[model samples]
Target: MKFRVKKATKNRTCIVSAAPYHPYQRCKAQGHVEFFSDFNKDSLFGVITFYQHKYENKVIVDGIFTTDIGIDGIKTSDGRPRYTAELYNEDEEMIFDLTSAVFNNAIQLVSIKKELINLEICGDEGIIGKAVVLKRGGEEIARAEVYRLDPIV
Candidate 1:
């Protein structure tokens, strides 16, 4: 028998359009992710683009994120790559984060629907939110700024 190893590539994108009546209706957000795994190299990158509107209601997010995981990536005590994602509101307060084991799986894709409530989106500033990725017990790896979407009138 013979075994051959090849590089693996994964790409994923998420698009969100909140309902007309939803608090996030005036918000626009998109997330992109890319991961490559191979016998020789492993790299992961992600970005988030977002816009917000004024509202006191809750915001519901719907989408799925997919990516490739390399053995060389961050690992858990059980020897599994550990990748995490987090979201923050205008105040820099954490809205949510994928930290559960279920977030890290052998599967190449995962589906997620999260609701963010009690967020302060009444700001006139274009910068409304931010998405970031941090190294395991280390500094930030990457970040994306979120902006406020102007009303169409």
Candidate 2:
């Protein structure tokens, strides 16, 4: 059997070319959720999108694509409710995924401590790498890049 491949468009992060079955519909119908804690003990959940693809003649999944921001629920000292901006990605197989949680609310707060973001990539040799960033907002976050160093070795 022959296969057709296409590059991802500017607006499209992931491109699904010719396949035995359709994967877009399957991903759209399914939703993956993740929960994380902020510095102040506030909780947030991220809903991820899952998709299936043909990699190296084998069926593999590109799981859980999301942005850095998850839920937009914030709290106020006066017992009021505040909403933050929501972040989303257009490309299903985009390069990065980020999630953040807020800590002590302070004016001119440049950064806070939070959980790491998750990144996944399917290499050309049928190897998959998953990475995570640990730190808060801004720079100085601990990042762990994982992948098979050498398949041939």
Write the residue-wise lDDT of candidate 2 on 11-58 in tens digits: 877655576654332111212223344322234322222222323222
lDDT, candidate 1, 123-148, per-residue tens: 44222545444344444444555444
- Provide TM-scores for the models: 0.37, 0.23
The TM-score that candidate 1 achieves is: 0.37
lDDT of each: 0.40, 0.31
Off by over 4 Å in 2: 1-33, 38-41, 52-71, 74-129, 132-136, 139-153
Worst 10 residues of 1 by lDDT: 33-42
Cα error of candidate 2 at position 68, Å: 18
The most accurate candidate by lDDT is 1
Give the TM-score (vs. native) of candidate 2.
0.23
